[model samples]
Target chain A: MQHTDNFQEITHHHDYDREASRKEVIRVTVILTVITLVELALGFWLMSIHQELMRHFIKGLICIFMLAKAFYIVGYFMHLKHELRNMIMTIVVPLLLFVWFIIAFLADGNSYKNLRNKYDPHHVEESKTKVDKPVHGEEHGAKKEGAIE
Target chain B: MAQAVPAEQKWWSGGKSPFNVEYGKLMMWYFLMSDAFTFGAFLISYGTIRFSSNNWPDPNEVFQSFPGLGSGYPLAFVSLMTFILIISSVTMVLAVQAGHAMDKKSVIKYLIWTIIGGLAFLSCQAWEWTHLHHEGAWWGSNPFLNMDGTKASTNFTNFFFTITGFHGFHVFSGVIINIIMLIMTINDVFERRGHYLMIEKAGLYWHFVDLVWVFVFTCFYLI
Candidate 1:
């Protein structure tokens, strides 16, 4: 008789636990919807101010906004926040480094492309300057058509 | 009479259960991480090319979807694609919730909804691709095409197709996987366990797919 009563009590407790988890799931869904709506609004707002922002801040603000949305998706939806710190660190630290690398590469690559354009007359005047005058007269100085070879 | 051999002595035991998530989940995590690096590489390469060229067409202009059959006003369909994917993510979350509660009926229903959303997103992407292809934009064949129909750059179209094409393949695979899970759920394979780890894992991958798109959208559309 005692075993039967204990079994009933355990089953009832399990039922309540499942119900609570269901409610939590619904709460999470609502939260995600609200955040995504906010992101949608922000996207439009940025577009409206794009011209002014581009001139003053160079579109970096848009990139920052994108990262913010990404963080919310990963941290909340993916539950990375509840994960072990080591696992979180493993993903986050490397991603941060990679992002920095991309930015550095873009900065350097753009500067180099600019420098090449300024010095390389072939890219600037490819149609008019048919005669290939090696700017430095070096073997590698042979200019290719339409910019970087 | 022989001494009893414990089940632990079996060759398969090896200190782990096959489906208790010891190896499966860990392997999934590793696969996802490597896949992420592949995406990162593509995006980084895209950045390199974008920075190297001048007079490159603004993504906002290039990605504008052809507005009707001949409306002459290109629309930003990428935003619509983003919205579809986000909605699919929500359905996926609901399916995971149902799976956790061992509600096989709701799990199957939500899985079907998620699959439908995936297919719709794929169709929209197909439309976007066909439009780009018709514009004589062979991958890397031309850098740029001016508004007046003159060629601008050859490098532009190359990266355009490569990056987006790679991401599309991931989405296609995701759709297929979800379909399989849906079928399995309907056939009562997952019902045996009273809990669906497969759905949870699929949800993780599906959410990652959405996450990747958000980055792709920002890079190739908004930027």
Candidate 2:
């Protein structure tokens, strides 16, 4: 077979270890499945608890599990872990921006909620009121008068 | 071209790839990174809206329906969807590995499995959206009340449909890319080129889809 120089340039020739790579893939798959199962179990457990603090804690735990799953998918499945360190850094460093992005947005949202509650008592009051029958899209015309009041 | 003179190699001396990967693969990685930011913005906006609201509907109460089994199974159907994507990702990994080994039969087998999984996940999503729409949930309508039985804002359904719809579009496109790759493989395009690098790039995309679903599941369903 004639091997072209263009082919060599376009593809990296790395040493392929069939047995080792297969074993690693299987290990990562198992780890990902177990993490997902644990996350599902926590989610189910969360439904039974009503305490605000407990719910928050479990949600936090679920978030951690979610991150773990992300790690495995990117690291093992995407083969980023096997890439050069420079390549990995380039992909990862930019993602750090999400930290500030999430913090600023969520903090502002909380502040907006507090400000609205303090100034617009009607909005606060309206959100808390319970409807005897939940309104559907089809019933919007019929309930227009009631909804206005 | 081998000159055994230097002790330390210059990785960035401008003759070799600095990252030791092909430019196409590197470009794919960057594209996926940008796509990640797009999703991150959507989810963060969702969290912002949820936090600013006086009360939010519990996802369990909202997504508590499984086809054929009726409603009341909270988090069950979505969990099934999650596993389906994960398993598909595993198949994608296998397909890429097969491509590396130049095993045409194994590559075709795993690619077919991955496509089937993608279609099944899309079907589940279609059923879900239909069921929710029947219950008066749409872009600007929400029939489900908050955990405290209080009225809910339209933002809940808005984000729900928008984010999941966007994600569904990704899955659809990913499947398309995989299908194209399968055809190319069948036609011996990569076999003639003597490398399966194209399949590797597609696998990266497929795995990225699964990664995004992880966060979406946790935020929308689990939490």
Candidate 3:
């Protein structure tokens, strides 16, 4: 096969500056690390909290941090920010679908749970009743059999 | 040829690459986009099930053990895994930068680091899985109880294994890809091709794997 020498001709090239690029990489790396450290700290803090509202709020904040970390990785490490606007749009537009996807699925799931709680008393009762010891593997199965008998 | 074009030349015209990227890179982006959805679906389903359940196991309780640390250290081991992946991603970016400069040696060096990072992450995951398995967590089994000590569903272990296992499969493939890139770099394939564009494509993939981990880590460990 003839290796086309026009490989450079069809592709658009960016001017390379090693020093500026290295500094940018280091900057992004530092940002990513700091964000991750903050996230870890939040995760630890979350362990101490028991309030439902507060827990939800902290989880939301962690999700936001996760998105920010994603932005840095894609925008810098993956070079999506440097791509042509047309390409960026092609990638970003489809991702918007996830918002609706998440909302609809979660809403439906919550509805299902509400319905189950109202109708399936057995499931609700079983889930609410605390067990003395969490059973495992064959032991859990054996206990179920004992209960059945 | 690119320089000869007028400054205001339409990028979307039939003659030019619309994204100003080579076809391989464009296709790789599209592929990653599709893969993002695949992972997104898996995670969304997991969320849906968790929402539908009356009670669920706490992630902190489930993933507290570290190798040689016995237990009780919540979020510690997974955080280490997260940093490993992040550092590997940095090395991947450096490799791609070196590729852009046609610096073969630097490219090789960074690629090796990235591969080691990938391997290290996989090993961490392996230890975590083995530890969980020893505790009787697997598909269709849950030795753990809900946060309130109520009976927990098997779905907890089910989704954990499936999603993390899937992500691990991606990392495993990524490591293999880097190895292939390393072998090519060693044989002077990119050197002869006059451009290290292939490395750039592989870099896109490596960074994407890292991107997925950010979500996986948050969903499984943090949230």
Return the top candidate by lDDT. Answer: 3
Q: What is the C-alpha lDDT of each candidate?
A: 0.65, 0.86, 0.87
Which residue pairs in candidate 3 have backbone atoms (N, alpha carbon, C) closer than 3 angstroms, thus clashing? Answer: none
TM-score of chain A of each: 0.52, 0.83, 0.84
lDDT of 3 by residue, A1-149 (tens): 13334345443254568889899999999999999999998999999999999999999999999999999999988988877676789999999999999999999989999999999898788878998664445544322211110
Q: Which residue pairs show collisions in model 2?
A: none
Q: Write the per-residue lDDT of candidate 2 for residues B14-98, one digit (tens) a residue.
A: 7676676777889999999999999999999999988888888899999999999999999999999999999999999999989
Tens-digit lDDT track of model 2 for A1-149:
25444345335445667677789889999999999999999999998999999999999999999889998899889988777677889999999999999999999998999999999989888888997656545544232222111
Q: Candidate 3: where are CA atoms >4 Å away? A: A1-14, A135-149, B1-7
Better of 1 and 3 by TM-score: 3
Model 1: per-residue Cα lDDT at residue A54: 55
- What RMSD, rounded to one decimal, does every model reach? 10.3, 3.9, 3.5
Grade the docking of candidate 3.
acceptable
